[model samples]
Target chain A: MTEERRPFVSARTVAERAGVSRSAVSRTFTDGASVSEETRRKVLEAAGELGYHVNHLARGLRERSNIVCLVVADMTTPIRARLIDVLTRKLQAAGKVTMVINTGTDEQSVASAMRQTLNYRADATVFLSGTPSAKLIETSLANGQQVVLINRDDPLTGCHNLGVDNEMAGREAFFLLRRAGCTRLALVTSTAHTASLIERERVFVAVAEAAGLPVAVMAAGPTTYASGYESARRLFGRSDGPDGVFCVTDLLALGFMDAARHEFGLTLPDQLCLVGFDDIEEGAWESYKLTTFAQPFAEMGDHVVDLLAAPVPVIPGRRIFQPVPIWRKSIRASAL
Target chain B: MTEERRPFVSARTVAERAGVSRSAVSRTFTDGASVSEETRRKVLEAAGELGYHVNHLARGLRERSNIVCLVVADMTTPIRARLIDVLTRKLQAAGKVTMVINTGTDEQSVASAMRQTLNYRADATVFLSGTPSAKLIETSLANGQQVVLINRDDPLTGCHNLGVDNEMAGREAFFLLRRAGCTRLALVTSTAHTASLIERERVFVAVAEAAGLPVAVMAAGPTTYASGYESARRLFGRSDGPDGVFCVTDLLALGFMDAARHEFGLTLPDQLCLVGFDDIEEGAWESYKLTTFAQPFAEMGDHVVDLLAAPVPVIPGRRIFQPVPIWRKSIRASAL
Candidate 1:
């Protein structure tokens, strides 16, 4: 490679240029290391002239890399994108760099992502999605890397589990819809069957069943806007359709609302009432104004960073955050 | 760290356990290194059992890190998010990890992000946003690192510049609105005068001036939804507002449309015509069928990866991709 042909500027070069010892140059670069102000100025000036950057890779071998790996699937999704943005900014504030591993909804890819975390010797790994193998978790723990799982009930030992209360949100959605004076009930979900989605679906269905209300559950396709649109078509195509619907995601809810309005000529709250999970920014748009459960992105990010910043290996435990209820025009005022 | 208390499993341990030489263990772990199949299998088994991961940081000191740094600002913005998603997925497929440096629209952050690139010895650094200093570019080139600037007109030597044809898109927007028989014209932009935004605004204003048409420009705040909404309120709040509006971004256009429709009670295409840049996914939503110019995200990502994969340093030049026009309900039929 052409890079190899050029000699890499080392601390020795900086030291000679600054007329200082190699150790002084090293101390000047090392974080929190003590160095005289005069020596630091000299070293920095010389280093700047020589284009000498501290080899963080080599330093990482001795100490922590301060790199955190985020293993995520479907990163382009609105909710996921928002979550990543929050986590990355929070981690950066904590003096850690984020390495995003896009494992596209596959177990094998998730395993590979975990392997990369170990390869880089990342200080921590946060799983925003995908189910990693138990063996990989064990390997990560053995290598001194903290593993944090979000919105997953994997019951894996030696990892922090942080998730929203999906069951509570689901139950609340049913109650909110019922309070809107809707008789027929339905649930719009996707075939993804992720832990959080499944939990929300199961609880909502159980709540409606206990109240002697018939509920139609549809998993038309993957958790996407198209799937929600398809679900609306199938459900509302019938003469007797749901008057109250609870969607597992904001994307799905928005799609269902559009198809219901434009295709079926149904007005929200009058002909149909809808509740969605994950209060994404689009949900608050003047057009959609979707009433949904808001995931505590900032709070969750703070918790993760706090765990990583701990001086000692943190006690691995479950930290369930409550999803805040965001009321908009999608649901009737009576529900509030 | 508790990790230091536990002895790190070394290659010697793996070699002894596998009944192979140290060189065999090393070769088995190193990519493209020659090792017998049986020896490789034995080494892997021993390494897996012992939970020994190859220190990629140390390996990167000798070889390339295979890390690509992406310096961006406002990553949560729809267009930036879409671009990042495409780039990360593509880079991962090419066996490189993505390090996103969120440089928050500040010059200092851009410099720090470049330093991080040098510290990690990334194979390449792509500036998705922010204008890095010429001195940093020279240092990066001197260190044999490929620098690729996107959507920036900075003629820094030794760096590849790839961007969309903002001038063409801006001019096309004007003519499209003119074809719709809208005499009065205005441009909805933001206070964040990035290179692309400035170019689009400049060209659009120049084109209108050349046509002897008065153009109203409003930059109430940053390039954001709220800013767009505020701009629309300010523009429409006036009685003699322009009927034809060109928004520099889809986000701005969506917000402008929402405010015009809900607040000002303006009907689209009949009372007003709108054009936007960046055909983000949200722009295609049923509520906001926004006419926009589509940025070639996939093509740009392919070009970046190809540049990084070149065997030798590529000749630094500009590659401008044409933005494709997306017809939607926001523009009049005559415009099509």
Candidate 2:
């Protein structure tokens, strides 16, 4: 099956010239390995004279090529909005053409996109969302593909995971509300089954309960402003309505705020305290100045690219992060 | 040079079975050309069995492959954010790689990036920019490379041009201000020196002057929020200064609003009217429902891909445009 395709200066040719084995040729190019400087120099001189370049493709899984597949849930979501652009450019600068796979919010579709990336022979893959099944992940790894999860949890124990600390971000938001003097705090919840949203909710409830204070949480179907708008009625219908509400995302917070202000005619910072996570650009606009926490997107993006291109998997374990709180006009402190 | 490039479809290849001449085969396939239904069916059946497909590339160079380069100026800019992701997906969807060229800001860097794209064997290239060029455009038709200014203005005639209509957009802002009853108006400008800003300036001036109203326009250097923050002194410096200010971009508008409200302690929408362009996500935030206009980015992206995929040269003096006005809460209506 190995057809004599395009004949070029390859690893075998390099191995012969360097008076070394094919694996030795690969080891020389690898980031770190014990190769004496004298021997390295000899190999370099022979390669330079012969106009031979190391075939990175033959190296162990990672060094083959810089090609990385960018798998995103949606093209226009505010969360992954800027990260995708920065990551793509950064990868391209490293001589990698990002095989962008747009998986429109379906896990199955994400898996199919992953299959296409594998078939196209990508060196590494970055999943923006949707946890790849362990079996497929193992298959891809078996075929020598590196996988990195961006702003998400790593389903595989040893995979590179890069994202913000959602639990601490949630706790910080709760305190911001508590500092605002609203004690009857409520968590604006969603049953969308996303890891990020789930982590935030867990933290918000844990922080409240740990302080020996009663905390309330309500789950609404899916997550969107439209959903939050509907949740306002259901949450308020309860006997013990909330004086403060914390949404998992800024969009949902805006929906909740709109429901309280425009719908219920409840003047903001007077009747209820509201806050959100993921300080999207829109959160600071005149109408929303939504006090929210932000996961450092630009830094996270650069880290993702670097980790995927790193010499070795430097950071181990599932990365847990805390988003920095961006104090804007939305919360109106003293409501906790 | 004119090797028969694998004939699009051969009549003889089909005729050997049809028992007819090449002329008979041509008549059968040509539209409105005389051919009996029986013969037509026979010819089509032969074509199907042979697995023949029509080639759309050669008609008027329609079949000739024309490589397109898609260039972007800073991905961090909100206007260009998520744009590359969409463009790449769309371009690849059309079976084109769109040799992406990333250029630095300032005219010289952008030109170098354009040249790099040209070096990649691009027949036509598109530049996605906010600033228009100051240097006279260079044209080399012999090379078959056409310069397409995407989302920017064209200085030279016969150059491909496409962008948002800033004039009508300006008028929309004017009407919003007029309705808000702001008699005194000022425009916060940037020194980005782009064609987009120039056109917006032109439209705003035309609308304001034609309305026979008192309006003051101030131009400032630097395009970021911090830049506008530094220029806040000028806004309050002038006696009988503007009661309403329209900024060239949402970022500038945010800075101006911050300066007017937080620093100067002026109530917004009452003491000053603010309008910005791009209708960026930030514009919809709680603090600055910036009444502004937006370009249909996705539609523009789709069109750019479509135009580049088709190899046929466009008719001279032809252009396509679509501009929209997005109304938010920043500018008050009839409150002067």
Candidate 3:
């Protein structure tokens, strides 16, 4: 457009117009600095005449920007996607701007993302993944940055941790499968390095071992649909495969179900029963009808934002939630 | 935890330490400004000694932050979730930070979101929804901001638009259904206010009316699974329902498929043929196996970010994509 860059109104001009000292104009703009009511009125009038607006970047040089940084490993996941959607809405409503960083599941990427956020001098930071560097967190905490960790548990004094109760969820899955009269139970999951998955698998296997149930553990490369399908093939290929399988995630369960029914020619609820975590929209589809646990994503989002928006809690409490189980056609009716 | 805020290194300190004029220090930081190598070296040494980082907020007051604002109506939608994920990765790789805002599908909320972006002085703004305000667009354009619109068609001179060929998609749906030897046809969709949906429905209805086909237009409340199921019940409850049904989206198609099979006791691709848009992950489930059109989200995201990261295109252009139809079990084999 070839528009010329207009010169900004200086405090000197406001001072001259207001018939006050330049320090008066400066004090008027500075928050909590003393300025008489008469001088403030004169500065305000002169500033209005010149159409002068405070340079927030210049102001931010002296203070913190009302910018919150949310670092997530991935946003494409259904749970994360829904959580981010709610978070952005709530934060925006609370008059806070949020910058989202999608750091891949690698230590180097996570470290780089943390460095970038630190450079931004964000007022607060929220780690949506579990892999944030301890050194980075310590640095941010040292700088008096309020850090909130979601889906991660850490005993650090400076950060607040929020997560789902994976252990309880694991126990529920074991009992649900046993009640369905499935003597053989299995757990299907990926080797993805998420703390939530690790906890769920740990507890589920421990419970099964305690009860002396015949259980199989199938692990795959990644937590994707293809991985789920591959895990299903490896688990079900054996003659002594489990009849009831609990998938660590809904997406994996979907993949397992599709592979079992289409490629393996297995009918669900008769030959096998499957359960999944995360009652995502697809779980309720007529085709899958997956019995699953619904992550309290909406509540978690609300709580996280509330903690972030408010002053640091007195004790930096750890908030944990138990996922709710949703029943569908994937499980036998007798179990319900 | 009670660490005091460290004092920031000011340009005056650098000037004094380097034994140079304050203007010389400012010119060194200013891009493309004249500064001798000796003076630059001195300023760098002095800055290092002082552990000084350029106050980006202060610098932003003069120029713009490398911040790109992404405005989406809802990130919970599958397509948007995938798009945002790719955009975040690509933008981060390009050294640009992204702030996401979820403005609900309403004029007031969209306008408010736009205002917030402008206040942040976003170097570039990308609207992932079609409902952005025209006035806001003009103001941002006048301010020389590179604005990109995805899934929205506009004749504005300065903004680049990326979207799918909704009209062509609609026609393809009609022909595919007709080829299945289904005389009865119907289009199922929500009353949501997306330009893409509007265009798709317009063409579908026009072609059906032109061909003198008996078509039922079933409209639901929101573009949700429950809405899709409700629409299916309303459509199928009638005695003379269409044998071939086209859902505007994959989620809706899933809902209809479930309701048709379970509630109505109808089999897919036998009693009724179904075609959906957007090849979402759930569509491939063993239960549905929905035949649908897949939007090239990854390609579109790359193009959008490329446009945003690079200098504004010499001539702002419109990029339209043709969705590829994915064949599955939902539609009659004869249709292929």
Candidate 4:
């Protein structure tokens, strides 16, 4: 059918044209509204002719938009920022509104942000930080709000947890390194007592010990480049530097690899073998080619928006995530 | 003066305590409200006692919250993500609400997102893209909104641009490399169109050509690691790999370095010397330790927010930007 184009118009004008009240017109555009589908088509067609671009913020005030609060912990990691970017695009398309709260590591600041997040009456809260405070989680649960954790393990019991299985990830690294004929190995993990790292560490150590291989553990202190630098000093100072190093996170691995190669001229799988978790975009770079546990961020992102859209009861619980390992040239086939 | 610690209270309670209407309490919290100082202080005290967090998004709905639309091109880089994170925190603290609009490489997406960005009745628009369209920039100016481009080039015309000088960065890298004594060199940069990369490429090529030294240009398409991977392959394919290679971005450098060392088994300085721009955290990783340009993301973040928070003018068009360089150990030392 041929359709005629009309001048751009706002929703107010569309409501006027449809002869329906503005609220009725709004209800037509709203998802999950009781408005008959027939009316929705009419409002949409009118909006099409009028060139109306819905003001989402206005919709929230009209109680027509469901707000999703995105709580991001740190921004230094490209993965964190990329996740936020991806979620923003998906949420915008799904017709849901987003409120971003960039919380600090400070407890008081986090607590304050949580309070502000509540005032926004977000339909759901997606916590991107590992180790989201127990106090904050309790408050969120008490308010009967749904909480979803990304790249975070759930210690809050009931919150929906979505992340790669760290235990399996650790084992994958250990087995891969062992097969690569590495005589000595080092585990590079940081000192943030979150489920994500803790589980990975526990599994890595357990598997390495069970195999009866001489393994050393290096606590990177915090997941930062400085920590990796320090770890390198310690590893290099050792009687015999590690032939293989499995970093718990990609950031630390990149750090370890850079310091080892650039500072000390160590080569991977020949002089040393390096592996990391989180197949961040940088890992595939011509320089790093970091062998890592590749979690499907896009898929996880899709799952997150869907999980949070519908409120779920938080039952204090545990969910161990499992992600496949992405193999690169960090280890040589001959060594394996 | 003793302050009473009251339990968390809603706005309604603050209204009751202040002996004013709910709307009055709202107006008091909102910026530029016509409330008396005494009344404003009274409302704030009550709200504080009750542990009330302002629902800025809600206030935004009522056209009370000064909406600041942040148009981010993308946040895939650690430095970019860090800057956006800092901007979000500062803006939130200042009571200026933030609404993000992502404008990636898609020109249509950027233009459409810009229109949606304007529908929010934003008091100002923060263009955070590397290449914000002239049309979008023009539209924002036409709408009489303050525009600030953080970590992006100053627009050719209209809007304030804040970014580091990547050209001087190139000059610095050359000097640093020359001091280290490598005659033949390779300069790898991301897309030649981005203002930052363009500056670096121009200065790098011009300076080397002027100095009568052989210089090869490696154009990495984007700022991601994958792009660097392809560039590194082509660079190494040369009859004799250059003694030193300079990547326009730390991320690209990391990738190029990874492919050279990990995949190709190239030894540092002997086979390939790597230096990159933007001393992102990953550049310091154990594997990369990229000697490169560095910008203070947190400082730039604070700087941009402060600019955005200042009184916006009814008149449009402003230019503001600053740059700094960070040096590391990715390049080779003077050949003895």
Per-residue CA lDDT of model 3 for A1-336, tens digit only, reads 444433445678889999999899989988899999999999999986764545445556666676888899768778778778878888878768899999876788887777666666777788877467777676666555678888776566667788888999899989888888888888988887577888888899899889998678888877777788888898878887778998999989989998888888989888889989988777777778899999887788777678767754334678898899898988888887
User: For residues B132-204, what per-residue lDDT tens digits would candidate 2 score against the true structure?
Assistant: 2533234223235566776566555545777777777777777778778878877777877777777777777
- Could you arrange the candidates by TM-score from highest to lowest? 1, 3, 4, 2
Ranking by DockQ: 1, 3, 4, 2
Ten residues in sequence with the least summed lDDT for candidate 1 chain B: B1-10
Whole-model lDDT, candidate 2?
0.66
| Tens digit of per-residue lDDT, candidate 1, span A218-335 | 8899888888889999999988989999999999998899889988899998889999999988889998889999999999999999999777778889999999999999888988
> Residue B166, candidate 3: how far off, in angstroms?
1.4
In model 1, the runs with Cα more than 4 Å from the true position are A1-7, A31-41, B1-8, B31-38
Error of 3 at A26 (Å): 10
DockQ-derived CAPRI band for the predicted complex in model 3? acceptable
For candidate 2 chain A, which ten residues in a row score worst on lDDT? A54-63
The per-prediction tally of clashing pairs is: 0, 44, 1, 33
Model 3, residue B184: distance off in Å is 0.7
TM-score of model 1 (first chain only): 0.96
Preferred candidate (TM-score higher): 3 or 4: 3
Report candidate 4's interface RMSD in Å. 7.1
Residue A92 lDDT in candidate 1:
83
Better of 2 and 3 by DockQ: 3
Candidate 4 residue lDDT tens string, B1-336: 112212224578888987777877888866797888888888888876655666555665544346677777666667667667778888888866566766665677777767766666576777667455776665555545567765556455766666676667778777777777778888887764676677877898788878877788877587777778778788788787777777888778877876787667887765666778767776765555567666766676676666666654422344333345555556656621
